[model samples]
Target: MSQVFDYIVVGGGSGGCVIAGRLSEDPNLTVCALEAGGRGDGTLVNTPTGAVAMMPTRINNWAFDTAPQAGLGGRTGYQPRGKTLGGSSAINAMVYIRGHRSDYDGWAALGNEGWAWDDVLPYFRLSEHNERFDDAWHGRDGPLWVSDLRTGNPFHARYREAALQAGLPLTDDFNGAQQEGIGIYQVTQKHGERWSAARAYLLPHLGRRDNLTVETHAQVLRIVFDGTRAVGVEVKQHGEVRTLRVRREVVLAAGALQTPQLLMLSGIGPARELERLGIHARLDLPGVGRNLQDHPDFIFGYRARSTDTMGVSLRGGLRMLLELARFRRERRGMLTSNFAEGGGFLKTRPELDAPDIQLHFVVALVDDHARRFHLGHGLSCHVCLLRPRSRGSVTLRSANPLDAPRIDPAFFADARDLEDMVAGFKLTRRLMQAPALARWITRDMFTAHVNTDDQIRDVLRQRTDTVYHPVGTCRMGHDALAVVDPQLRVRGVQGLRIVDASVMPTLIGGNTNAPTIMIAEKAVDLIRGVSRVAAQPHNDAQAEPHVEPHANYAPQARTVEARHAIA
Candidate 1:
């Protein structure tokens, strides 16, 4: 006999962990979580600096590659996702940031009720337990632990000084009243260890809850549907194929890239695409794998004069050994560093409603996603466009579920995006040239000689890639292209819901992890039929000024022409 669960959460990533953990809290309900990766409790996932080693190796990452992008000069970009219990959160740089207020308000403007900044702020507060802040804007009792950087490098202070020198304000809290400023970031850490979603919501309750079942290394092949309703999932576990029955619902939280792939593989995509792939159609949802979006990022690297920055050398190797010992004993020192230690938000134009660009100051020379290494110590800065107009899709490479899906982000397909990248490059260059940082820079390793707009564009076309924040594939809304409704239920299917970053109608203005957790936090309410009301008081002062949905600083016709030409 097959054991039945009231709820089955697939892919124990950021949203999966939260959904499973919250649903299992009811002693009467049986919840099961299926993860396609190993337990995320290893030392590498716990140590903040461990990401440096994990980025280049396939240790716990599904380091997939994108289809060659025309906008990127036919270069294939790298896409590394966490193949562990916590998913990408386990392998991500631990910076914790909630996007601008208008990001959620924009969702409301797009016909997603109950998702405005006022409505979602409570959920964000509910999921966070910030160590340094306890106010109406923040919650003191939550599952996720957010803290200040324990090992504050000297270079971090210098980065802030440079930002001020470049005419940027210093903000103590990026997640507070305002987001447009520069400062050291607060990370998802607990007493200096990485606090992944598993550590926050799932790990402590694993064995204690008898109704909760967690299956690791279980790969789900397809959704078992009875007509239009999702009833169960076909999974392969430990060399055996089986069906896990869901009595009430099945939540797909396999992330932005894989969630749509899972849906398409289950014969629930565009009818023509499914037929072409030789799969019988279960549903004819044309929006299943469309609307792919990601932040297009470019890095500025320079040789550093200080040994404080990370590098490959005998002296640094010896320091790492001592740091490891210190980490084991006190949980403090260089091992606690999340490489992109300091960053903040900025608006390129003063008239913009919210920040259009985000900066990440790194203590290492990261080339090609850390796949390429430099011999000497250095520092780098990542400038990523907060919102991009380009769109792409995820399609099935084959009918087999084991095959990786084809990803096309279509970066800079819209000319406005390229223009913004160029402006952002110039702005970031000014910050890098500030005396605080320029004093340590020995020589420019990437873009020193480039001066003209065409030269900058050429450099961006050759080197730009993702910052790992992809969203909007299975976007939620009431539009013709919306795959999921405002409640997160698959529009044409029953007993199925998507609660990951994929459901975002538009990408948020900052990191997506915290918002993804908030999605699950609100999802449990909808699943349980509970009336969820905002707990925090709303203030118009914190509200963002209204702006058009797809407003861009560039002339509209030029951008449209560029988009059409690229298409």
Candidate 2:
């Protein structure tokens, strides 16, 4: 007999971990979490500074690459997502950001009810246990621990000083009232180790409960449907095929890229596209894989004349050994830092409602313009458009679940996207030229002294890539195209929900790991009926949008555009 669970959560990533942890709290409910990756038991994965190398390696990363994007100088972008228990959060830079409040309110305005800044702030607060700010903006008692960077490099200080000199105010808290300014980033670290979602949400409750079954290295192929209702999930575990029955719901917590691909593989996508691939259409969801969004980033690298470059000193044979010795003895020094530490949000043009660009300053000299660079004394700064005007999609390569999806970020697809990136590059250059950093920095490492806007635009096109924040594939909206309602339940499928970054109606303007975890927390309430669905606020009142089995399916049309206009 196939084993049954009250809920089956796929992809034990950041959101999956949170959702499984919270849902299993009820003793009556049995939750099974299926993770495609191995056990989260690697030393490098837990170390704060160790993520940089481990991220690119196959140990903890998926290391997926995109199809050649014509807009990006015809280059194939490297897309690195986590293939571990904690998902990308396990391998991410661990930066903690909630993005602009307006970013959330914009979703509510887009018909994602109960998702405004006011409604979601409590969930963000509920999931966070910030070490620094214990106020209205931040939470003190939560599962995730967010702390300020303890070790600030000289370059970080210089970066902030230069930003202030360039007229950008030095705000202490980017998560505070105003986000327009430069400041040190707050990381999701504790005791100088990465406190990933697995560590915070899953590990503690692993042995405590028998009702919660976590199957690692279990790659789910597709959701098993009885007519239009998702009743179970089929997974391949250690070369053995297994079907886990779900008594209540099947939650797809796979990240943006994989969620839609899984849906399409199950024949729940555009009828035409699925038919072309010989897939029988379960439901014609045109937007299943549409509305893909990502943050396009441009890097500015320069060589330092002085010995102040931390990358050079750390990469040195003797210095690295010394740092490792110190790190092993006591968790401190360069080994304790994530290196890409200092950066913040700022308005490129004044009179804007929100910051237009986000910056990330690193202590390493990265060239190739790729990750393959001599760790000599060099500095790199990355600037990305906070809200991109462009969009893309994820299509299935085949019906096989083992095959990776075709990811088309279509970076710089829109001319407006190119313009935003170019403006961001110019702003970053101005910050680098400020006296504080200019006194220490000398030659341009990557661009090598380019002064023209077109030259900068070229540099933007050549070096730009995703910071790995992808969302909106299974978008939540009040329109026909919406895959899921505001409560995260699938529109055309019963007992199926998506609780990850994929369900975000609009991409948040900052790091997405934190918000992903918050979504899972909010999702728990919805599943338990602690909170009502968007349109159906009354008890026993079902939202008409909730699709049942054997129903005539017709997706609603939606306008794919951010309500918060980028001025």
Candidate 3:
């Protein structure tokens, strides 16, 4: 007999891992997780900095690229997604951040109730075991471990100094009372090892319950539907097709790009779009792939003289081997740092309610992520736009699930977006040239001496790229354009739900991994009816002073940093 499960979670990513672990807690409900990638068993993934090389490699990552974005000077952006058991979390920089309260309020405003900042804060707290903060916003007992850095290199301090010297305020915690200013970023690490979703959720529950089954290298082609309700999934394993039945529901945690693509492949998207692809329409959800959003990042590199540089290539071949040996032995040294630590949120203009841009300081002079340079002494500061007005879409290229979809982020399509990015670039340059950074700067490496607005704009256009935080493809809302409801259930389909970054109505102000996990926690309550369906749309007027935008950007005018992957 074919295997049957109570919950079949497609794509064992951040959300899938959490959902599978949480739902299986009952021990009676059978849960099965399907992953397209191989197992997560490599020294490279366990060691903090060792993941750098594994990130871009085909062995562990999907390494998908976007169709040329019209807004980004027609350049096809590179999108790297994790394919391993832990998904992107396995290959991420492991930064842990919950976005500002306003981010959730925006969702509520759009008709998803109970998703407002105050309502969802508990879920964030519930999923975290923070090493610091035991007050209202944080938790002390949770499966996931969140902690501050135990050690810091010289470069982390210098970067913090630069932000202060640039006239930006210095805040101790972005997740605290305020998000503005610069400080060291808290990471998702335990004893210098990456605490990925697989490690935190799956590993603990594996083999403990016969009700849970994990199918790796099993690529799901489409959901098996009995009329309008999803019955199970059709998958391919070892080059052979197999079908499994779900006694209860088929949860889609396939993420932003894949969730929509899966829906379309299952004939659940716009009627016309699916018909055009010669697929029978299962459900006509017009918003299956609309309202796509992501954060775009602009990086500034500088050549520095102090011991602030953290490039591994700076040392000799023997020295590099020695460092690796040390990391293997104790999980300490430069290898443990995520490099992207030391970031803060800041407003481009003083009148804004909350900071619109964020900065991440890296000790390495990452030219193509340290690919070409044999050795160099420099630093990189990446600035990301917190909120963007421009939107994009994902559409099916073919009815086949193996075929990738066409992704158009529509990045800088609006002139106002260009203005915001330019402003961010100028502000970041000011931080780099701050008196605190003056003590360490040997010279400018990437964009030499940016004094003029035009110069800053030019540099921004040339250097801007993705920080890998893609979201909002299958947005949650009450409108006809919304793909899913507040509970993350697909609007027109039964027994099918999307549970990844794809369901976000708007991108959060910070990294997405932690929030995605929180979404899973929130979803559990909604599915079990422990939480109420949204009674009213999110109220911007009711939002605290921090989250409401002083001015709303035209959907086409605002630009965001195209940071889609994990930090």
Candidate 4:
């Protein structure tokens, strides 16, 4: 007989870990988590600086490449996803941002009930154990550890000085009452180590909870359905095929790219596409793989005169060795750096309800997602349009379950996105040119001598790509195009739910990790049929309304012309 679990959580990523961890807490419920990748608890995964090593190698990342983007001058973009127990959170920069409150309200406005800023704020607090903050805006007793960067990089201060000089305020917390400002980021680290979702939720509970069973390297091939109800999952592990029966539900937490692909492979997608792939259509859900969204990012690389920022050199190599020694001995120093150490949210236009552009200050030259290497040392900053209008899709390549999905982010497909990218590029350039940083920059390595509207547009078309945040492939809403309902239950299917970034009706304005975890935290309640109204009392002041523009910070008139010209 096949092993039966009350809840079968597929893909042991951020959301999967949370679901399995929380559901098994009931003691009466038996939960099984299936991970396609390894345990992901190695030094390379736990060290903050180890992201550089993993980003380039296929060590713990899917590192999938996208179909050539039509809007990006026919360039195939790189898409690196975490293929480990914690999923992308195990391999990401570990920046802990919950996005703007308006981002959630926007989802609610789009017909997703119980997803408003007020309803979701408590969930964000539920999973966070912030080390530096203890207030109504933050929680101090959650499982996930959120702390300050242990690396005492002097350049972080310099970046803040540059931001202030460029007219951005220094905010103490991006997840606090106000999010529009420049500041040092709080990372998902615990005592100078990367605290991935696996570490935060899964690892500690392993073996202790008899009801929870985690199986690593178990690749789910397809969802086995009985009529319209999902009953089991076919999995391949160690060259052996097996089936695991689910008594209650099968949660899909395979992320935006793979979740949709899995749904299509399981015969639940556009009927025409399924027939073309030679698969019998189980459900003709046109929206199963549509509505792809990601932040289109552009990087500004500057050759630096100082070695404070990470670079390639003999002296830098020696510093790295010493830093490794420091890390191994005391668990602190440069090795704890998350690379994109300093950045914040900003509004290109003052009248906007929230920040439209988000910045990521990098201590190393990140060219083409680090695929292209530079010989010497430098610093780079990433500018991404937070609220992009362009939408794309994730489609199946073939019937083969192991085949990579066709990802078409279609970045800059909407012309307004191009205008925002140009504005973001200009804003980032201005911030980098501030006196504090200008003194160290030897030259602009990428965007130099580019000033005209056409020049800016050309640069944006060539250089812009993803900042690794992708969502909405399995969008949740009440509309016809929505694959999942607001409660996260897959429409037209029984005993199935999507509990990952894929269910986001609209992409959040900042990092997706915090929000993804929050989704899982809230999902357990939905699954348990608990009333959120009586859960806990929270301060409404935490979800403050958008601030009016200050007289001194009004957007320049030239920006209007630039937007029109680009359009």
User: For residues 1-567, could you state the per-residue lDDT of candidate 1 as single tens digits?
Assistant: 336889899999999999999999999999999999999999999999999878777878889899999999999998899888899999999889989999999999999998989889999888999887776567768999998887757886788777666766666678887787777888999999999999999999989999999999999999999998999999998899999999899999999999999999898989899999899988889998899999999999999977788998888888889888988999887899999988878877776889899999999898999999889899999999999999988899999999999999999999999999888888888889999999999999989889899999999999999999999999998877899998999988899999999999999999999999999999999899894555455774754433223211122221121000100
lDDT of 1 at 20: 96
Per model, state how many residue pairs clash: 0, 2, 17, 0
Candidate 4 lands at a TM-score of: 0.94
* lDDT preference between candidates 3 and 4, better one: 4
Error of 3 at 372 (Å): 4.7
Clashing pairs for predicted structure model 1, backbone only: none
Query: Can you give the lDDT of residue 510 in candidate 1?
Result: 92
What would the C-alpha RMSD of candidate 4 be, to one decimal place?
Answer: 4.7
Off by over 4 Å in 4: 531-567
Q: Candidate 2's residue-wise lDDT over 267-305, tens digit each? A: 898999999999999999899988999999887887776
Better of 2 and 4 by TM-score: 4
- Cα lDDT of candidate 2 equals 0.81
Worst 10 residues of 1 by lDDT: 558-567
**Better by lDDT, candidate 3 or 1:** 1
Model 1: residues >4 Å from true position, as ranges?
Answer: 532-537, 540-567
Every candidate's CA RMSD: 6.8, 9.7, 6.9, 4.7
* Runs off by more than 4 Å, candidate 3: 306-308, 312-322, 369-374, 449-451, 531-567
